[model samples]
Target chain A: MLNLRPCTLTWLVLVSLTLMALAIGQAGLAGWGILALLLVSTFVKTWLVAEYFMGLRRVALRWRLIMAAYLVLVLSGIALAWWLAARAAA
Target chain B: MIWIFIYAELLVFGILFLAYAFARSRNVVLFNASQLELNRTAGAVNTLVLITSSYFVVRAVAAIRADRAEACARWLLAAVGLGGVFVVVKLSEFAAKSAAGIGLSTNTFYMFYWSMTFFHFMHVLLGMVILLAVWWKARQGAYSASEHTGVETGASYWHMVDLVWIILFPLVYVMR
Candidate 1:
């Protein structure tokens, strides 16, 4: 029988996401589109770490939202910074 | 208390990351060029190493939850071993850069690269130490199914370390 726990499953997803990000980097593609994908991948991976690995999934709602907000704020800030830079360049 | 510490640590890293992004925006060309010089393979591999270590830590927690102290200790040891691998790989990366005459003063990108990564590297070392302490207690059968707060606390801290790297890898090495 093949049984997998939540942590094991989370690890599998995390590894897959890491590999995907690596592929994106190696492809040498650049644009807002590519950046978006990378940022999204990052968002998912970090969220997984927070939820599954950190055991925040069973925590109080306030704590979980705090982590969620941290991810959103940081990632959105990154996106904004890049957008501003791109606009300035153009 | 650990959660409070975790939040504080997250805040610190969050500021550093925002600073990096802001600086990159001001000098996208320089940042992009310098990023290209980084060994993405090494960064990717380190990402794998840390993530695997986090998985091991998770296993350690699970083992303790089952009242399996020996298994928990062994799992923590495994995680710590992987942490050593991370240290070795990172040292080699730093050594390679040093051999190339790179330092914090190399440029703006390098300054951030060295400072941020070295800072995180220290945290990895601390996390290893913390895990080792927890493993020692576990080996003595200190944790039980009903009371394994120490294991969870240490595991939480280690996961925080891994979480930061998950962001760092893409932010520094992969994203341009």
Candidate 2:
């Protein structure tokens, strides 16, 4: 049940690309929204890589949680910095 | 042990990411302006290349698990070929940046850019070496469905490299 088909991984890659393009294209539209979108997209893409491509899906739940938390910690720091910088600029 | 190494590598990069955020917060305007000078398209392309290569690696592992030694070698070779493309594309991107007089001392952002990406570039080279070794062993029929830890170990390391780039691309390129 934890199998990640190659086709599924390919689709995830394309979805990530689309998210990247959207984030880039809409960067100037709304600063906070763009930052949030980019960070969320980053977290999602990373989860896909870890769970599917890296075969973490077949591993224990604890390991998956650790990976998820690590990603969140890093991205949250970045999102905070982005928000702070925006506030300072404003 | 490989998992330990992977986690350690992730920890190092995580610290760097935090440091980047701290630095960027101090000089938001300069960071944003310097980020503009980057070639997002190149960054995005590298992202695609690495992700596709990672997929190729998954296929290689799958081939080995299915006891297809020749197919496994072919998949690993293809992955290495794509990794070569990543090297070329990254080098070109770096050359273009250098041509514009950018370096580690250029600014805070460029400093992080050069350090993080070059660090990752080295890892890519190392991953390719591991994959090459796996490919050689695979060619010699060294792995079977029940005895493919070598392939799994190498694939795991390569995926770590891919995972880093997945976050690095948007964090550095598109998240301005």
Candidate 3:
């Protein structure tokens, strides 16, 4: 049941490349907005990898939920650290 | 279960990523300045390469599901070839940094960068080994559409390596 459709896999690849482009475009900009955007892209790409490429797409819903929550926790930790750093510098 | 090991690996990398964030928070200026010196283009290219390899890996697994052993082996080999590309790109990036006299002791930021990426680099190597073994077995008709768990297991680990890099690229290279 781990048969991911070809179209879906191709679409995920395109989405990831587009996200990379967005990150590169915003790399030199200095602002919370840019930072948040990069972090969100990381989140989305991570989820796509976990769900599709890792063949977790049709697993038990609980497993999917757990991975999603763990992802949120990790990204949120990084984001919170960045926010705190910015505030301290301010 | 391989799935358990996969999740465990994710948890480990998650902690390391947070540790990086915590370190960055302490000296934001140092982290930002050091980040400016990294080879972002190489990092980006490696990201694309890893994701492409993951796609190839998916194709390999799909091939096995369809009972196409030779096609599956070919796809796995293709993924391994992409992994080689990632190694070349990453080594060049590392060599460039070293040519400038950068090392683990260069700064706190570089320390994290070197150690974390190197750790992930090791995983990539290990994943390729697993893939090579899988490819050999696959070519020998060791698996079929109904019993290709070996292919799935190898692909799972490779994807885990790819997944870590996906989060790592933006977190370390692009985010400010």
Which candidate's lDDT is highest? Answer: 1
Ten contiguous residues with the weakest lDDT in model 2 chain A: A21-30
Largest DockQ belongs to which candidate? 1
TM-score of chain A of each: 0.92, 0.72, 0.71
lDDT of 2 by residue, A1-90 (tens): 658676465547655664565457445443677678777777877888887788888988888888988998999988887777767877
- 1 or 3: which has the higher DockQ? 1
- lDDT per residue for candidate 2 within B64-98, as digits (tens), equals 88999899999999999989999999999999999
lDDT of each: 0.93, 0.84, 0.86
* Model 3 C-alpha lDDT per residue in residues B49-148, reported as the tens digit of each score: 8888888888899899999999999999999999999999999988999999999999999999999999999999999999999999999999999999
Q: Per-residue lDDT tens digits of candidate 1, residues A1-90?
A: 769888899899999999988888887778889889889989999999989999999888999999999999999999999998998999
Give the range of the ten consecutive residues with the poorest summed lDDT in model 3 chain B: B36-45
lDDT (C-alpha) at residue B92 in model 1:
98
Off by over 4 Å in 2: A1-19, A22-30
lDDT of 1 by residue, B25-121 (tens): 9999999999999988899999999999999999999899999999999999999999999999999999999999999999999999999999999
| Chain A vs. native, model 3, TM-score | 0.71
lDDT of 3 by residue, A44-87 (tens): 77788887777688788877887898899999999899888878
Error of 2 at B106 (Å): 1.4
> What's the ranking of the predictions by DockQ, best on top?
1, 2, 3
> Against the true structure, whose TM-score is highest?
1
